[model samples]
Target: GAGVSQSPSNKVTEKGKDVELRCDPISGHTALYWYRQSLGQGLEFLIYFQGNSAPDKSGLPSDRFSAERTGGSVSTLTIQRTQQEDSAVYLCASRTSGSGGYTFGSGTRLTVV
Candidate 1:
């Protein structure tokens, strides 16, 4: 993909069900980040990964949320035991580690019903 591409642009899952959102970053970029935006809210960083840098998982809301990067390219965010509060837009952004414009995916709108 020329830019970040996220799977399942919209997902509606029953409460307590787990869901996985995928992200494909731009080719040759080294920095990738995951963020969540609640209803009309600012983005909350979830994780950050840069080539060889320690994965910054500090922003993860709980153990129920986890993500992984493979080959420094694609990533996946998984949410477990979803609650109504879990409903939000999961966004993926990628940029060159040193300097570059961040490209954000359309985002996955997860709604827990």
Candidate 2:
């Protein structure tokens, strides 16, 4: 894809189950980010990957949430032991440089019951 792309646009899962969301960033982009947004809420940063430097996972709400960007392109977000509160739209964004514009994916809506 020319722009950021996310897989499994919608997911419904039982409580305690786990889910994995994928993102493919634009080619040559050196920055990638993951965020979550609940119903009528603002986006909350989850993690960030920039070049070879360490990923800033400080925004992750819990240890159960994790993400990784591989080969500086594709990224994945994993949520363990999903709970009702974990239900939300996961968004992925990427940028080619610090001052460049960003491209965001449509997001993956997760519903936990």
Candidate 3:
């Protein structure tokens, strides 16, 4: 893909249901990131994957949230036992290097009832 792509732009789930959001980043990009934005809140960093190193998972709110990047090109974010507080727009971005600008996907809007 020429840019980042995110699947199933919108999702509505029961309070306890789980959901998986996918992201396909630009080819050759070495950095991938996940972020969350509530109704009117600023983007909150979730996880970051750079090259072959371990991902930074410090931003995950709880054990229910997890993300993984495969082969350094694609990624997935999973929400387990979702809660209403989890409702937000989940964004994915990819960059070629630390100093480079990020190319962001449209994002997946998760709605937990």
TM-score versus the correct structure, for each prediction? 0.96, 0.96, 0.97
Give the Cα error of residue 21 in candidate 1, in Å: 0.4
Task: For residues 28-63, write the lDDT of model 3, one tens digit per residue.
Answer: 999999999999899999999999999999999999
Better of 2 and 3 by lDDT: 3
Pairs of residues at least 3 apart in sequence or in different chains that clash in candidate 2? none
Off by over 4 Å in 3: none
- In model 3, state the lDDT of residue 51: 96
Residues 1-113, model 2: lDDT tens digits: 68899999999999999899999998888999999999999999999999988999999999999998888889999999999999999999999877866799999999999
Best by TM-score: 3
Full-model lDDT for every candidate: 0.94, 0.93, 0.95
- The full ranking of all candidates by TM-score, starting with the best, is 3, 2, 1
Mind giving the per-residue lDDT tens digits that candidate 1 earns over 1-113?
A: 78799999999999999999999999988999999999989999999999877889999999999999998889999999999999999999999878767899999999999
Instruction: Estimate the lDDT of model 1.
Output: 0.94
- Candidate 1 wrong stretches, greater than 4 Å: none
Question: Which has the better TM-score: candidate 2, or candidate 3?
Answer: 3
